[model samples]
Target: MAFKRVSLIVAVAENGVIGKDNDLIWYLPRDLKYFKDTTAGHTVIMGRKNWDSIPLKYRPLKGRDNVVITRDQSFQADGAIVVHSLNEALEIAKKAGDEEPFIIGGGQIYKIALEQNLIDRMHITRVHEEFDGNTFFPQFDENKWKLVSKEDHAPDHRHEYSFSFCIWDKIDDSQ
Candidate 1:
């Protein structure tokens, strides 16, 4: 048996904006493809509102199990596993397998996971611009994390957007 850890995969603007009106703040085909390819076979956890925000056709992600995190006692979706807290989400993730599941989300899920130390890895896209956004990712002390890799994606014909992909891991203070 192996240990389970929480991982988040997200793309945001340089200004830390994540979403607006329950939808993504920006669109870049390369970034979207990176997200889909990286998370294809993993489980994905998100808050109920985020689930609802996705279109009906895209609600249940293809080739990946969808786990909806909700505080309501009666929350359920057609093909989603509903969990009340991050603990329960992690428990279910462990049963799924050792490989960390993707914590795909809006703002609330990121906030809670950051608080519980549930996040082990982050695959982030720093889009080189900013816009008005309703949701924001929580800010953390940089001393607690170290960047492992970065890739600069040139603006493509399909998407006139420039972004940098970055991966980071949490530093163990006890070590």
Candidate 2:
């Protein structure tokens, strides 16, 4: 079956930390808004742990199709679709008519997607500071991605750390 654009969206610290204890370590409201705005009408695929980490009130992220990947056969997520693998999740997203499906991850899921070469684009918020964390965004070869755009924001009364919103597109090796 044909698929539309597939992307990964994440926020990473200077040290590549994304989260800790299955939760986000920082409170970047602007970044959060950016995430919501960018993904409002698309499908978001995530690992089960990532799905659980979301607050109860935000479980099925509003205005988007939530597809969770889990290995447990009996697992169920109310208001969200649960699948056993990334490929299954992607299929669901495509069948749902999502023009661009996003992989909103926990560490392992991100690593798997990268290793499988399943991502076509990436939307990253690069936090300027580093923090102690158990979850890290998987590293990829910078040479294989082309930075499409970037917007920097400095810390203000509302934001603590400086950050840059970066958009990257995977280089088409077949070209």
Candidate 3:
């Protein structure tokens, strides 16, 4: 509830690989469907790298809001509210009526959001595999978060790789 809620969605391999040269670690269709289903009608916040990495067909993510952050004034996408900083992103999210803005990431952007206390929950799908990576997820701090739920899933015939969906919520020190 600090500003608007932010949730991070990521698929990391067993070896902690999040991305390889600005692309995803794997090409599993199931993961894509999971992403589309969860975020289909939500506001999404991301940095320039994440925005550029989005394919044209999935650019604005049908039926959802897209907010992109960048220092470049020319960084604009139709239907995506572009901003210069995280605070601006929050302001844009404010207009969306207190809905959680999904923090679909690229390494640096996720780092910034985590450091800023913007991420409220993490919707991570851990792929049971490893890959060569150019970018990796930041080490999660258990002191700041707690795993709330998880669902282990078998690989669909199309995906060929098993995965676990996890949800982590912020930890309260008041307890």
lDDT (C-alpha, whole model) for all candidates = 0.84, 0.94, 0.82
As a TM-score, model 3 comes out at 0.91
lDDT string, candidate 3, 9-115, tens digits:
99988887899888876777877888889877777888888888888887877877888899999877777889999878877777776477788887788888888
Clashing residue pairs, candidate 3?
Answer: none
Q: Going through the candidates in order, what is the number of backbone clashes in each?
A: 0, 0, 0
Residue-wise C-alpha lDDT for candidate 1, range 98-175, written one tens digit per residue: 477889886889988888887888898888888789888888677898999999987877766789999989988896
- lDDT by residue for model 2 over 11-94, one digit each (tens)? 999999999999998899999999999999999999999999999998899999999999999999999999999999999998
Question: Which 10 consecutive positions of candidate 3 have the poorest summed lDDT?
Answer: 1-10
lDDT of prediction 1:
0.84
- Give the distance in Å from residue 46's predicted Cα in candidate 3 to where it truly belongs: 1.1
Candidate 1 local lDDT, residue 90:
67
Q: In candidate 3, how many Å is residue 130 off? A: 1.2
Steric clash pairs (candidate 2): none
Query: Higher TM-score: candidate 1 or 2?
Result: 2
Number of the top-ranking candidate, with TM-score as the measure = 2
